[model samples]
Target chain A: MGSVVMHNVVSVDGFIADADDEVGPLFEWYGNGDVEIGAGCTVSKTSAAYVQPMWADLGVLVIGRHLFDLTNGWEGSPPAGEHVVVVSHRPRPEGWHPEASYFFVDDVARAVAKAGELAGDRTVGVAAGDVGGQALALGLVDEVAMDVVPVVFGSGKRYFGPVDSQHLLEDPHVVVQGDRVLHLRYKVRR
Target chain B: MGSVVMHNVVSVDGFIADADDEVGPLFEWYGNGDVEIGAGCTVSKTSAAYVQPMWADLGVLVIGRHLFDLTNGWEGSPPAGEHVVVVSHRPRPEGWHPEASYFFVDDVARAVAKAGELAGDRTVGVAAGDVGGQALALGLVDEVAMDVVPVVFGSGKRYFGPVDSQHLLEDPHVVVQGDRVLHLRYKVRR
Candidate 1:
């Protein structure tokens, strides 16, 4: 019913976050799109227009329990959309949080299924991390998108979950998002 | 003195080589400048001119022992230059097979020092893997360069080596290498 897409910003070395779990700066390119980056660096205007449509078109978001906990249940407004599903081994929290709407599912397949039901014909965006990798391994993900940041974390959480076997991705749509950020979009070959 | 730079082509998922240790197809974009990548994907001409200077500027290449063994001592010619240093814990092999100039060193610092000596005022490039990561961790690497290929290996060897802590990098020189490859250059902040 809907496509499942995984998206996130990662360093050139594929670190999604630093050891301290700082992801705010990896997304700094989003706030400043017209700054001079470094020598031999140039931003393409085509890359600048990628974000807005992505947010508007996303009808559902499926994330992991860890991400849900890290953001404190998104404090009500998760970046993706109004309908959010968190894949968690634990049951739903007892307290009511008015900040965001979240559906807790124990597994990735169920999360995708629930997200598709909630999204209708729209797209279901899979939040980054181990959840995304699980989706990829399960052949439930349709696309993988990333804003490849210029920073090198040297250590931290990787965007790709460790898959035992190889999973080939179709050639990506590569574009310079900002002066230093590269936006890469790939269709997962199921 | 010479700058020690680490360079490699990696899939968007951060895989440098496949499980079988094959790196040929990950670099296919360098040969085919124009081809339909995947759905809605096309090669950009601006991304085509990124190879020559990278190879010409390298003076010495510092690689790991595993890579040296994999190539059987680079058979004929190493990609970076004639003068190469291999970082290994084992003893030097007996007799040369007439390929490239190779120096075996046990430590990362020694390899960098040797490469610097051999390179003169030129740059010493570090082949990706344990050697590159070791250089980065030791604060000996000056630059980190990568050709971000559009494919996803899902599983394979990563470009980074295990470090005790995180190493942050400065703003990078970003350019489109070829139709589907993005060349990223980062100056390591020592």
Candidate 2:
């Protein structure tokens, strides 16, 4: 089975977006530099070196329904990954990007399991938020990755959702500094 | 005049402590390593190198009334700095540590000014929370320093307090990895 990495670009205050779903400046690093990493994305050379390979190895992405409706499942083509598993109560919208490889599962565990099956040896990337929090609490996520931006969002949608208990992570094994972001990766302590 | 640096050990979620004023695991890094940082504090050598000089240059410490009450103002002997300025409407307790250089000021700005007067050429360290937030909003803070511990506090007393607006910070000039903490410093963008 492939490793599941819960990831997001978070504010210094740990918010992925505001209550209204505005990401604010969280994605600024994607366009802040001259280095291009395909799909119209450009980032600092340090960030490209740190993130490009991760995107290349991503085979499946698991996200919550809110995200699916937000970008219409990234127009049926996720930023990375060949397949997408959306944890939603409703089925995929009828006749919407029928050729795209997208799966809708109501439960988070099943969604991750399906993503794992699709990913094989490739990495499964879980969008950080409610679904990611559930997967992490259930001990399904192997790593936690964050592209930490410097801005502080005092109140917004949290990256970890409403995690009731604390989760310990090993010291970050990867710490890379980019133009306006810091990339950190930590293994989920079992 | 000395620089006013707002500093705190914060959770990945940006909380300095729990609602009940308990730090929980946020202070774990202070005792998790072998390098002694004086005052019976031991931390990773990396952290010591990054934090020791910053502490050595501290001339005054500014804190909110809540923290003053929590630790009784650290029993009139602050962790660092020669003088402590407490922002409180009520005056310091009658004859409480009169021998210690502790000053009581009701307003955050006034407290910072008093701290600066006491600090002179040395740095004025402000404890992050409500008082620090107010000072930053008033444009008194020169830098923001965080010792980010690798744990998520789903909700708690925020490090930035109730900052209603976004504050921009320059990319961190300092990024030091310690045993269980990441030391980061960012200048408050003017």
Candidate 3:
């Protein structure tokens, strides 16, 4: 069996961006500098310490059209390590990453299934917070890790909603730094 | 100047609910009880434990149509202790609440401003998850607390969205838990 993992930065007030659709400020908060805190551990070394390694492990990447546009140039695109799937009605643009094999799917489920199928024995990383929540709601995500930022977007879009009522979380693990940021993890239960 | 607070429950995966609008199911995860545990400092026997006398100071309640219906008090209306503001496009029903004042405003801003005015020296409570999140995004809520349920609602409406990213938490001043519910308190920065 294969699984998808989603990681995101959410505002303290439960928003991802402001009303202006800008998440740059939130990104800037984590982009200060990378520092190696201890053995195999680092704090704020490049946006997030966990993202780079997590992204590296993924054999497949599933992203939404909006997220695709946000990264511009397929973002860390896994450097020839991961195949990418994009869900969009829009046509692919010219001069896209050739190393990255891109497929346009019409729905979230198809996009997810394709990622799982392509992932083979490896893990599939679902990137967008919104879509990631949707995948979790659909019982597709196997695990989730969130590096929750302490800033409130003040107005934009929220990551999740008041959805179904029967879903459950197995164990909640977290590393808290007294309000600076929290890296939380949860296992999805069916 | 006014500040808003967020009280909520998120899955270890950081989901407020599943894909369905099922808050009731989320509550069952706390081990079958309604109140999870005691949190923060309690002001009264009738109030949530996390809520202090400061929250009770807010004398008004603001909510959306969905919540008003969900609570199912179309006939008796809100109690006399607090003035209730319902944000909806429909016309206000004649003599909606026998013991309290009911103002139905289409615009969110108006509803908020009027609530502030009516609340006078007291605080204003933005009711329901959806409307509560909206008010927080608009920078309307001053102090808030939520009964965080454990269920992972499968598929319906979500309480917050990436769209709700307008604001983030300033500091998590408190965390309280009951057997089936949790109470989280977050401050909104101006």
Candidate 4:
């Protein structure tokens, strides 16, 4: 099975977004550099090298329902991956993006399992939030990736989301400094 | 005047300590390696190289009263620095560590001013928390240094304290991967 990596761009204080779901300056790096990867996104060469391969290898993305509603499933075209698995209690909206390969699962574990099946040997990217936190707590995530921005959001939506217990991760094996972001990847300790 | 750097070891979730003021695993890296920096503290060679110079250049430390009370000002022997400035409304305890260069000040800005005066050309380290937040907000901080540990503390005392506004920092000029810790330093954008 492919590895499941939980990922997000977060503030220095660990907030993924503000209370109103605004990203503020968290996404600044995507446009701050001269290197263009794809989908109107340009980043530093250092970031492109670290992020492009990860996006290319993504076979599926698992996200929470909140994200699906927020981005409308990214208008049926995610940043990467051919398939998306959204964890939500509600079923997919009727007649919504019929051609899109989006799956809605009620449970986080089941969602990740379905993502794994869809990913095959490729990587499964899990959006970091409530669902990602649950997947991590269930020991379904293999790696944790963060694109740390330089701004601090004093209070807002946390990146870990609802996880109440401590989780230990191995030292980051990948550390790449970009224009306005630092990319770090740590393996979840078994 | 020397640079005023706010410093602390924080969890990936951006917490300096738990609600009870326990650091838990955040300080584990200080003793988890072979290279002994000083005062019986050992750390990875990578960490020592990055941290020793910072410690050696510290001529003064400014800390909030809560931290001073928590550790009793590290028993009058701080980890670094020749003088310790405690930010508190109350004066120092009568005859408490009189021989130690510990000063009690009633204001954050005043404490930092006194610290700078005492530090001269050496760096003045400020413990991250409420006082640190105020200092940063008041534009008294020159840099932010964090030793990020690989654990998630769901919710606890924040490293930035009650800072409610956004602050921009330059991309970290220093990023050192250490045992169980990632040493990062970013200059405060003026």
Q: Score the docking of each candidate (DockQ).
A: 0.45, 0.74, 0.31, 0.85
**Candidate 4 regions off by >4 Å?**
none
Q: Between 3 and 4, whose lDDT is larger?
A: 4
lDDT of 3 by residue, A1-190 (tens): 4667765666544456655557754554453455643323344643346455565567887777887787663543543235877877776667676555777686778888988888897788776456776777777778766656656554456554323335565544433443346555566656
Residues B1-190 of candidate 1: C-alpha lDDT, one tens digit per residue: 8677888888776778876888856766655656333322234555434555566778988888898898877674766676888899886677666455888899999999999999998889997777888788878888988887766676678787665465666766655546556677888766
In order, the Cα lDDT scores of the candidates are 0.75, 0.90, 0.58, 0.92
Alpha-carbon runs more than 4 Å astray in model 1: A30-48, A98-100, B18-20, B30-48, B98-100, B177-180
TM for every model, in the order presented, reads 0.84, 0.97, 0.59, 0.97
- Candidate 1 overall lDDT versus native: 0.75
> Which model scores highest in lDDT?
4
Candidate 1 lands at a TM-score of: 0.84
Model 3 Cα displacement at B64 (Å)?
3.3
**Of the candidates numbered 1 and 4, which has the greater lDDT value?**
4
What is model 2's DockQ versus the real complex?
0.74
Decoy 4 TM-score against native: 0.97
> Candidate 4 chain A — worst ten consecutive residues by lDDT sum?
A157-166
Comparing candidate 2 with candidate 3, which one achieves the higher lDDT? 2
Per-prediction RMSD in angstroms?
A: 5.9, 1.2, 7.0, 1.2
Cα lDDT tens digits for candidate 3, B1-190: 2333333555432345544444554544334434423332222232344444545565666777765666644444443225778888886666666564777788777888888788776667665356766676676666655554444443445444323444445555655544444455656556
- RMSD value for candidate 2: 1.2
